[model samples]
Target chain A: MSTGVKHFIAFAALAIILIALPKVFVSGSAHTMMSLMGIMIIFALSYNILLGQTGLLSFGHAVYYGLAGFCVAHAMNYIAREKIGVPLPFIPLIGAFAGLFFGALFGLISTRRAGTVFSMISLGIGELVASSALILRSFFGGEEGIPTNRTKFPPFFGYKFGPQIEVYYLIAFWCFVCIALMYALTRTPFGRMCNAVRDNPERAEFVGYSTQRVRFIAFVFSAIFAGVAGALATINFELMNSQSLGAGQSGLVLLMTYVGGVGHFIGPIIGGVIITFLQISLSDITKAWMLYFGLMFILVVMFSPGGVAGWLALHQPLLKGGRIFRLIPAYALALVPMAMLAAGLIMTIELAHRMLVDAQSDGSVMKLAGWTVDAAKAQPWMLAIGLLVCGALGLKLAWPKVREAFAAQSAEVAQ
Target chain B: MTPALSLQDVRKNFGPTEIIRGLTLDVMPRERHAIIGPNGAGKSTTFHLISGRIKPSSGSIRLNGAEITGMAPYEINRRGLSRSFQVTNIFPRLSVFENVRCGVLWSLGYRYSFWRFVDKLRDANEKAHAIVEEIGLGARRHAPAGILTYAEQRALEIGVTIAGGADVVMLDEPTAGMSKAETEQAVALIRKISEGRTLVMVEHDMSVVFGLADRISVLVYGQIIASDTPQAIRQNKAVREAYLGEEAH
Candidate 1:
């Protein structure tokens, strides 16, 4: 299929999945989860606008996302208190405008020097705002944060979204619209010039497009989308605070997007969903979840530099025909060790945490496999050995088949 | 006859160091002109002045009687002038076809095209294909420009300059590193390519200069010592002493 057609089909599939999610799951937790995915999708894709399309790395993108969330919350409170009166849905637009204003303000200065300088300026801005989130309590609501309600809107679909499912549709709709606009922007003439500027600024200048102008336009557009995400998040959660605009949030967005893939529009989408899932699931299972997350990010950066989109693109042909079934054995062999190692590591971490934090009497602690051991005397060597043995066996069994699959895929595409 | 391009009392200096000192030359329309000099002789600098890559320190540059000394490169390009660089400046990541298409698009009055899709523009595509074929790169039209051989890259550069359809075309060392057959092919390409236009070049190869340029200018230490028809240049004592003296052996 043509590239455009393929992209359209992929977009359609995504929309269908998002629309049917609440019904298929029929759970409040699933709705909240989907809403979180919607918010991250915006953040990651906006970040991709600078990093992937313009060849710029920004370290303070969370400032816009976080600030926009704060702006939306303020707007929501104003509406609720009759300081301003309108539907809650229109408030995200206010968030987008806030994002655009700040993005342009920062972009004007930051885009003056592209590579490392831009990254540094963004980092500085992120730190500055995160620290000030406490000072601006009147507007930012201090540490407690300000709360607003989606129920403020007149009931449109016979539901006020007091439930998370109603909010999921709203967030999902906005996410789809923003992603589509961002995608369309990439295909525009200005978008092509963004690529040109990314590749060679001098050449783009000679061709009569100012490099700064292109970069500035892209920067502002990215910020607006990020802000929209912040606004959507506020409506879903019914509160906003400094943490919404914090540097950590910015770093998380970057990690998710890069892990998903930058250049591909769909990459950010996949990344947002997966990272959100892991953030919630992993944290519950272990205190060292963040450490594992960092290691996983680094591994992805090193091994699959192109991220998940690139990895999936590489596997596209193999997944198309009778050869699809051939992947099962490889997948199974890969999954066995991966599952074992993950479970073992989580078990080890949780058991350690329980022993230390909730110590048992008689100086003995309960273990994962129904055994009790002296908490102070428990050795980590056995857990390490088990994880390593399983991991090594998994790698050994997976490599040859994985290599064969890649080689076959390469050969098939070359023709 | 009126000159197509003229540089009168052109002197380019950076801070205190003088580069092109009081240089004056004239090329009539349709003349194949060559400037030859040793390194730091300001031959490339003179091209930079004419192409508007750099403004002249003193004096004026005129193309068909209108002064155009300090105009921007694109403005100079728009006003019936175009040039290739000493180093190949083609966009490496783009396909050979896309590179030429960009050249054709700007020349065909479609620059900064936001509304027109590059692939859907038939006229630009056809013209780009024609130029690619002209430059002997039709077979590799889809290949990235960076992956092409050095000789092919130079040929592609020439194609880009001419693709603009400018009145005066300047090529800097068009066949600098090509083999014997490739240089011969380059000379033929230059001759065929510069048919109706006023062609200006800076060449080190005496053989190529003798075979191609109708008028030759010899420069020594940033000053043109001889400007004459090829026959006169070949016989001038100062020209021979300044340039051909070392090559006589």
Candidate 2:
């Protein structure tokens, strides 16, 4: 099929999924989760504009996200109080404008230089905003943060956004629009020059491009999108807090972008979904879920520096050559040892935590895999260690077969 | 005829050390001038000074009778001056076509244009394609510049240098790491691209210098010892002892 047709079909499929998702899930929590995911997808993509596309290593992107969120929240509150008759869904535009305003302000100073200096400036700004958010209680609302009622706004088309599902559709619409626009920006000459500046600033200058201008433009655009995401957050949660502007929030977006693979356009989307899923689902099961996230990020960096998208992209040639199915047996063979390794590692970690920290309160016995095991006992320790060693050995033994199979398939495809 | 580029009393200091000391030279319009020098003679430094990569301590540099001493590199580039680095400085990750297209973007008046898709710009694509074919990398146009062979990368470097359609082109050791056959090919390519354009080159290869240069300047210890035809430079006693002494063997 032609590429244009493929793109049309892909977009059509995406629209269908977006429209049908809340219907299929049909729960308030599901709507909430999907809305959060949509907001995160926008946030991640915006971060990618600087990190992935422009090669600017910003440590304080959440400044834009948080600042915009706060601005939108305040606007919403004012609108409701005055009965200004603005529709609920159009509030993100206010966030976009606020983001653009601050982006232009900060971007002018930060984009004067690229690399370490720019990163340092962004960090300083982020810290300044986050700290100021507390002292300026009227604007940031102190520890409580500013709250707004989305349903208070006059209904548009006779539909009040009181229901979570309504909010989901609103967020989803903005999400699709933002994604399409960001993707289009990447295809433009300015976007190409951003990559050039990122690769080699000297070469870019010789080619008649002002590296700082390219960076500043990209930074502003990124901030605008991030602000939109922040606005979505305000509408969804009805509150905008100082936590949104913190370094931790910035780091979370960075984690998502890196894990998704900044090299490809769709990488951040994958990262957003996976990281959001992990954040939501994993947090419910364990309080140490963040540790898992750090571990996943490290693994991605070491094994697949291009992130998940990059890892998947490696199979493109095989797929094109009609040889992707050839690696299935090898992948299946590797899965058993991989699962064993994960189980053994998790067991060791949980048991060790129980033995070291929780031992003072809860004596000896730890519940794992529905089995009660004595944490202080030598027998259980030996069992855990044996499983760990066995899993490691099994993986070591199985890896060569997977490698050999891959090599064979590659060689065949080459022929 | 007016000089295309003129440097008067050009001197560059890096902290305590002076690199280009009291260097003055001029090249007439459309002249292919070669600057030959020994190691550390500041040949590349001179290029940097002209291209605005580094500022000279005290000097007046002019291009087409316009002062450009303290201008930024892009500003100098905008005033019809383009250069390539001694090291292969093509964007390593971008495709060869994209690399050349980047060079042509500013000259084509597409400065910071985020509204137009670059692929749809027929003039830019055609110009970039012409450059790729001229550099003899037509088959490898789609390859990432990093993956090209050293000689091919050198060709790409030249392609990028001339892609802007600048009237004055400065190439720093464009054939630095090439084999003899590759150097011949590069010299031919350089000769083709530098037609009706002012070419300022810093080269070590005597054959390329004597073969392609309309006039040759011999630089030694940050000073031009001789500025004359290749024949006169070859005959000058100061040029012989200062630079061409080893090459004479």
Top candidate when judged by lDDT against the true structure = 2
Candidate with top TM-score is 2
Error of 2 at A265 (Å): 0.7
Instruction: Write the residue-wise lDDT of candidate 1 on A151-229 in tens digits.
Output: 8766665766677776788898898888888887776556666676776665554444456777888899999999999
In candidate 1, list every pair of residues with a backbone clash: A66-A244, A66-A245
Model 2, residue B119: distance off in Å is 1.2
lDDT string, candidate 2, A49-136, tens digits: 9998999999999999999999999999899999998998899999999889999999999999988999999999999999999999
Clashing pairs in 2: none
For the second chain, the TM-scores of the candidates in order are 0.97, 0.98
DockQ agreement of candidate 2 with the native complex: 0.90
Relative to the real complex, the DockQ score for model 1 comes to 0.31
Error of 2 at A124 (Å): 2.0
Among all candidates shown, the one with the greatest DockQ: 2
lDDT of each: 0.82, 0.92
- All predictions: root-mean-square deviation over Cα? 4.3, 1.5
TM-score for candidate 1 (chain B): 0.97
| Separate clash counts for every candidate | 2, 0
